[model samples]
Target chain A: MNRVNIVGIIVLIAIAIASPIIAGSFFAPPPAFIGPEFLVQIVAWGLIIGCIYVLLASGLNLIFGVMKVVNFSHGEFMILGGYVSYWVSILVGLDPYLSIFVSMVVIGLVGVLTERVCFRRVLGTSKLNEIILSLGLIYVLQNAMAISWTDKPIQIRSPFEFVTVSFGVVRMGLDWLIVIGVTVLIMAGFYILIKRTEVGRAMRATSQNRSAAMLMGINVERMDMFSFGLGTALAATAGTLLAILAPITPQAGAIPALKAFTIIVLGGLGSTIGAVVGGLVYGLVENSTIVLLGATWKDAIAFAILILVLIIRPTGLFGEKEA
Target chain B: MNILSDLRKGLKTPKIYLPILLLLVCLLIPLFGISPYFIHVLAVTFFYISYSSSWNLLAYSGQASFGHAAFLGIGGYVTTIFTIQTSIPWLGLLLGALVSAFAGILVGLTCVRLREWFLALVTLGFSIIMVALTIELHWLTGGVYGLAVPSLLPSVNHYYYGMLALTVFLVFIIYLITKSKIGLAFVAIRENESEAKATGIDVTKYKLLAFTMSAFFAGLIGAFYAHFISYINYQIFHLDYSFWPIIISVIGGIATIEGPIIGSSLMFCIIEFLRVIRPLVETIDPVIKLNYPKIQVLLMGIILVVVVIKMPKGISPWLRKYLISISK
Candidate 1:
């Protein structure tokens, strides 16, 4: 791990430890567990949620990094993913984990189609035009879902049987472990793909300069579609996993999308590692605050931190200035 | 021969004659046996005209503010809180305007330093923050349930007249601003910011001035809106409401004095008419439960896409060109 990662991990661990002590002092609590067990649960939730955010932000970062286009509909794509899982589960009576492959494929095609039909035409336009277009698209997709599925929140019941693993003092749901495990698996796979694959090299080249990549025989249009599709598919997958953790609604994607935007900005846009680190930081800040200071201030924390980041370091922690 | 000459000269100044004629027609609508509900819609359309016109003032200077809804919220919330929470209505309006203007100045200072895109992002951030605060600070804002407000006018006609007068006042204000050297300053900033600054234009002051002025009227109208609606909620000041004015200005043709007026009229008509189709369809054909909300959003998206693709200069520019060509 790099120095930043090391520093981030240490700070996160410190926050995890200090949070419960702070919470216990603040409010009357049922003594669920003592020192180590509480600490482990907090860390586990923090890591799992943080990694989910990173998953969301990484896709967003890639889209922004390469195309310099902010997809306002990113959250909706995730919601769409959740809805997909919801339906697939109902139709096949299959496990959500087993359906992930099918969900990704459908959303991947959606990403490609969205890029080709809408975003491709608007490429190279002024940022203002692109922003408005994406926003309009968001309205369209959000309302479409609302119409198709009555705008009510639906719980996608996890197939995981209630199993808790106790590591000395720490004990929690088996589902939580799956979340962390999946996050790690996805992160590792993404890292290898970007670092080791030819497509990843082409993406890097295009992100550096589109015209330059075209001159180097890289198909710029195809690359753009691929990047957008990859980003969008990842967004859907994140949504699907998040559905396992919580309930799903047509409008569920909006808040998560905002959080993802914050993470990407905080980590520095388009930096893959930065997105993951930022996501973890965000998760800790959000979940820890909820644990310690009641659930009322959760959304506020996300935006407040984002504004602070923007004001302090507009370039973000690992951000390169975009053209 | 004298009458013909007079008519010809009058026709030459379409701007002056056209608005006066439209105003006369709007004033006569209540006399035509139209329902009060339709009148309310017209009042809202007028209100949006003022709101979107002020928005165009900022857009003219090339600043797209997402926090515009915050100013509107501030105006509405401040006025309502004072009216309901305390024994004041007029004082609330003034104070709300001041507070909203001050908030605009603060947001402007932070955002005006950035590029247009960053400015939009920051404003969008502020809008979201404002919405969140409205929900979180339920004690003050009444949360998602909304706050009941006292009316500035005693009746719907009173509200209608108030909105009408305000709309006309705002249109004249915007026209005067754009007609002057400041209008040229706005156009300068829009076309090329660096060049405008180098040419001795105080770009920063011009931008800040535009933003503050835009907020001033936006806040003013929002304050009046709270009194007119007699209720204020998070929904009224949500980001969705915030977006309409921007889209209006864009669809109407950004920066033109009459653009927002036309844009607001068109949007209101579209929304109102499209809504009518739902009930009509349900009555005439019972088999289909027409989803109005879905259709409305879908239509708006399609309109936005089609407008950007076909009429990038917006409708007003084209209308003006066509009119001029026909006259020639």
Candidate 2:
């Protein structure tokens, strides 16, 4: 946008790119990096994790855009989706991948219900109320899941668990490929829904201006529910993927949720493309930092980036509104 | 003589005397020869009052922190490390507050310009980062296993009295600040930052002051908590620590002097009641018995949702209004 901003962006990019090199050489030994093989593996891991974040964060961005409400409990819905998929896999004997659709629909309904029941009344109230309400939902949902399913981490064994895919030098698991593929498919569907459909137009219109959209005969209230549901469905999809990737515990959603929030903020509060880019960058940075600094620094690195970004551009990288 | 008369005149009013009466009642709880368990609960109640009041103070300035446990954990760890190193409990407590205040100022500097959700997330991030650092620097912080701290006072009675005294003093100071011009500036900023800035208020200064003060008290209580619990750990930074104050403040009243006290007392009582009746309820209904541990949190969530929807101003103000109407 300006010379100073451009300089800042370039500097940040440089630091991000150089961090792995710095970590490998300066902090820990370079033995962890078996040359380009590890690098490719890290890149692949980053893409998969980044895609999950993209799905999670874009949902958050979508909800924030239309509803102007930041759902702190969105991650719980993701976990709920994971649990639903787990149960569906166990009971219905369907593949976890196939049951993801069921999880999405179920969690989508829960999201809409949550919006109507809890969030609707506090929609235009103080931001504190919305935050508190979501915090309450976090306790409710997490505890509910803990009570029902217990806090023990449950892994959803994917049907493709035994299969592995190799792309040139980089080898990947079939589950990772499927997760990434599903993420791309969902994101593309989201794009079409937003850019091509009438509901998408309504959602976009409402996000642009609520009262104006209301004046134009759009049911802004219903659109709020729809967007919230859709946002949550995306989060649930991420959770379903996460279950396949790793164990899904009740409290497991908190960190990823925080990361998703960081991504949305980094990209811009209401920008879908910003979320995707931010997620990718975050995933890459996080994985690379783990490579360099070990796993302990992984969580801190994302927030450090967030704090740095906020200090430089409080409105976020692509945010339209002033901080 | 004149000041004494003015004080006497102020005490003649029910408003002044009621709180004084309440304070006396609180002090006499230790005198009533209550069981050690009850004393423990009372001490914890006071702890929550102190913590929630500090949280409410920040919220009064229109800055609701989601990760206040950051300050709490900082204070706890600082006090533990300091006292372990120096064996001076009082100095450790003071330094803990100072360190937390300093950290608070840094966080506030980053967050003062951000909006509500961003501020909350950033603060939450800081708490998470603090936890990470604490775990990473296990050589110093004892890692997740946590470090034991010497008690401030050996006896539960002494500890109860200490907490009560601190609570009373801190609450008085917060009361004075909220009633003063600085408090007015805080309210102004909370209501409309631009208007306050236009009116010559340095928005950053007051907001940072609120953050510093809130963190100081939180740290003080955290130091006390470490001593009372006889251990300090990264678990102090848990979300439960953060959420408890919010629950107390929201239930009691937001932006009110009496809110945190009432909220903390009520919540403490409810939690205690649930604990007492849990076994009985379990015997009656095996289903509830299975979920008994989670019921308190579930109820808190439900109450929080109900309060936000039905009584956003909280129960304290509603009680005040109802009482006033009844008297009228």
Candidate 3:
């Protein structure tokens, strides 16, 4: 939108492209160029990880856009979804994949309840109140899950465990394929829901202008609940995917939640497309940083990018509203 | 001349002496020969009062930082590292605060232009980055095992007295700041940044000043905490450290001098009370015992929700209202 922003974006793109090459040349293996395979592996892993982030960040962006509330506890909902799927899979002896839908539905209902009980009262109040309230919810949800399930990290056993598919030089697990496919399908369905359905129109209308939407006779309250629930359901789906991909713990949501926050901020606060792009960039940056600077720098690099983006463009890449 | 007049006016208010009286009572607690454990809790409570007060200072300026533990951890680690390398405890403490102030300025530079949720997220990011760095640079920080720092002074009674003195000094300074023109700028910025800017207040400068001062005090408390606990670790940057001050500030009163002091004391007592009752609760119902942590968290959550919904002004202001009504 402005000269400074365009220049900043170009500079960042140049750095992102050049860093690996520079690092690879200096820190490459003795054979040299073998590092390319490692780079490929990192990229593949980054894409899979980014897919989960897309879901998580999109949900957060959706809620913020529609309700104008930042749900700091969204990660807890994701973890809750993971736990639900885990329990359902274990008790009902269903596949983890199938249990994802069940977890999404359950968590969606929980989100609706959360909206009505915790957030609804503070809907149009001070931003600080919403933050504090979400924090309180974080404590309640994380501790409650910890109490019921214990704090030990547990992995949901997928039916496709031990199955890996290799495409040329790239190898990935079958579960990852399904996870990516499902994420895309869910995102596509969400896009359709927002673009085609009457409820979707209401949500977009409210997000654009709440007062105008209300004047148009839209049931803004119901739309608020619906959008919150839908956003949470998306987070739940990401959680289920995470449960299958990695170990799930009550505290597992904290870091990813923070990462999702960074993604939304980087992608622009209330943009779905920005969330997707930001999530992918975050994933790539995180994984590549690991390759360049070791595993310890993975989390730090994501935040570093976030800070850089904020400094250059305070409203974020796609953010239209000024803070 | 203005300072003397302000002091005189402050002294004219009878209510102003309440905290002084309370501080005297706290100082006199060890004279009764209290248990070492009680003294430890009291000292930690005082430390939290200082810490929460520092947090309130920034919030008073209309900036709510969620990553305050970054300064706390920085203070702890910097002091511990300095003392470990040089073996000069006093210099280490001062250096720790200075280093934390420096870090705060860096963070504030990135955050001064942001507002509300964006600011909160950036601070949170910095805290997380600090923790990651602490762990990554394990050779210096001793990694997850943590490092032990020398005690600030011998005995729990000494810690109690030291913390009490520190709390009093810092709260007084904060009170002075809040009453000054700088404090007016902070309030103006928080109330309405655009209007404050329109009035030529240089909102960024005051906000950054609030950030620096708050971090300096938070670091001081953290340095004291490290010595008091005799252990410093990356875990100091955990969400618990950040949340404790917020919960206390909300419970006591936000943006008030006495709020953090009251909130810290009450919350510490509640936590200690729960700990003391754990065995009794276990004997009565073993199932509940297993869920004790969850129950405590649930209660805190419920309290936060209820407070935000019902008494958003918090306990201190609420108490003042009741007192005024009863007097009438």
Q: Which candidate comes out best when scored by lDDT?
A: 2
Docking class of 2: medium
| Docking level for model 3 | medium
Off by over 4 Å in 3: A1-36, B6-13
- What ranking emerges by TM-score with the best candidate at the front? 2, 3, 1
lDDT of candidate 2 over A1-323, digit per residue (tens): 45644554455466567766775586567664468988899888988889889999999999999999989998999999999999999999998999989999999999999999989999888999999988888988888988888878899988779898888987889888888899999999999999899999999999999999999999999999999999999998999998999888998887788889988887667877778877877788888888777787788887877887788777776665656
Compare candidates 1 and 2 on lDDT and give the better one.
Answer: 2
Candidate 3 lDDT over residue span A254-319, tens digit each: 778878988887666766676877677667777676676667666776777778778987777656
lDDT of each: 0.78, 0.88, 0.86
For model 1, the superposed segments whose C-alpha errors exceed 4 Å read A1-40, A320-323, B1-11, B135-139, B143-145, B283-290, B325-328
Q: Rank by DockQ, descending?
A: 2, 3, 1
Which prediction has the highest TM-score against the true structure? 2
lDDT, model 1, position A259: 75
lDDT: worst 10-residue window of model 1 chain B: B284-293
DockQ of 2: 0.75
Pairs that clash in candidate 3: none
